[model samples]
Target: MSTQFGAASTTDDVLAGVDLKGRRVLVTGASAGLGVETCRALAAHGADVVGAVRNLAKGEAATAAVRAAAEASGGSFALIELDLASLASVRAATDALVASGTPFDLVIANAGVMAAPFGRTVDGFETQFGTNHLGHFVFVNRIAGLIREGGRLVNLSSAGHRFSDVDLVDPNYDTTPYDPWQAYGRSKTANVLFALEFDRRHAPRGVRATAVHPGGILETELARHLGEGEVEALVTSLDERNAAAGLPKFQLKTIPQGAATSVWAGVVASADDVGGHYCEDCHVAEVHEGESMDGVRAYALDPEKAKALWARSEELVGETF
Candidate 1:
């Protein structure tokens, strides 16, 4: 009840009493890092998992790895190709799932890019915003029917959302200058807002949605764009933000620790009860102000902004759910 599961807790630690037998789970970007661990943990607990990835080869390898890790639990793993950057791919993946008619208990939107140079996705939106937010948006809405009653949408956001809010006016940087971190922040903010609105619309049907900041830097492909000195610079900036917020210095987490909150949100019945909240370190995070570098900002949780984002997303994707 305290949600005090610290940065040291792993998916296994948080999921101790939670039984996932026969549950159907999906994880995006599941080939490595937190995604792999999330699948392993779920599968280890007897949940059937399908890891959606961009590459079939990598996905197969990841599935094997997770399967091997999960042998002790008598669980299973499967794979499907899903490139969030391409709506065509997302549609195909959803079609495959719909064909299989596997009702999902949870869908984790875990794949994302970070701090890359200015560019646009194939759909012409900013790379980070397009892939991280819009891609997940379309995929989730399309599969809304495939989600069983009381299912959960776990959008993996970031505490870096403290850096900025969604820029509805210039989301694609058509009229404004682009800053990488700011763009990433906007996407993360959108992730939370998306979950907020998603809960509003889907709750009546018993499906709930929530966003999570997995907490701290872990070794993942998401950071592939970072340069030599960027890691230290990012940490220095994070420390400064923590100092400004009167918080303790942020500590880096292990891969298992990084996946804890996500796993908690997905399978913990109590967490689903707190739908639409932003969680971190396996607890509902506090909303803070000004350079906190931790917690969800009030703006990210605003219902109005969430609705506005929903509208904008519909326009961008040229489709409405």
Candidate 2:
């Protein structure tokens, strides 16, 4: 496919002339930030949207715009309860979906925690890894059958994935000291690897999967874990580094811009171009090395690493797909 969209494109921009009247999409983390915008954009294009949210009350309140857009476009929006931090909740929610037997054209794993303080999930894994990766790992695999052939899965990874690779041996930081950024990086990297492997496993059935980095967007709840001035400080630091390297200063994206890539990869782009890859700014990213904030790291897309992480994830969640 020709590249027509770029970094500044919004969800609406990507879906401008697309029609989705008979399609169904499932978006996790649909209550806030990029998730909400993704749902709204797809629904506005006439897709039936199921938003999987952790808090029903919060989701209902946050998705009012989504509902209105869907109503106006002849689409529909509904919320399903799903808490990624707990295995029990993941199982229950997925089981119900599977029982419903309704097929989905796409699934977006957009829920995740970023730079959180050290903690563990209900199932005893590190908080970030558990919620961001393992939880979706099981959730998606459980409903893999519900995804129609030729459907797709878009995992919301991050540019932060360059910070570190997954530590399969010490996933919970059992021995190594825990650092919030590193933990978040590991989880984000796992997101990419998960997509890579899932695409490989399901591509034969015409179901594709890919991961996306939504670009930095500060006006969202994702930064709540940051200290009062930490966001500002981080941005300044990044700008300084970029200036030293003769690169443009770092800039944050709007929620719509951040969500553009997700919808693009899941709906607009050719599945063959995006399958088993990591995408950003509405395009497939190249494998880049070093400390730059632009492209996916090789380690994140290593097929061997993806396979290992998939196996380890199954072990951790006590489930296989």
Candidate 1 wrong stretches, greater than 4 Å: 2-4, 269-272
**Model 2 spans with C-alpha error above 4 angstroms:** none
- The lDDT values for all models are 0.87, 0.95
Measured on C-alpha atoms, candidate 1 has an lDDT of 0.87
TM-score of each: 0.96, 0.99
Indicate the worst ten consecutive residues by lDDT in candidate 2. 287-296
True-structure Cα RMSD, model 2: 0.7
What global local distance difference test value does model 2 have? 0.95
Q: Put down candidate 2 lDDT per residue, 3-72, tens digits, no spaces.
A: 9899999998999999999999999999999889999999999999999999999999999999999999
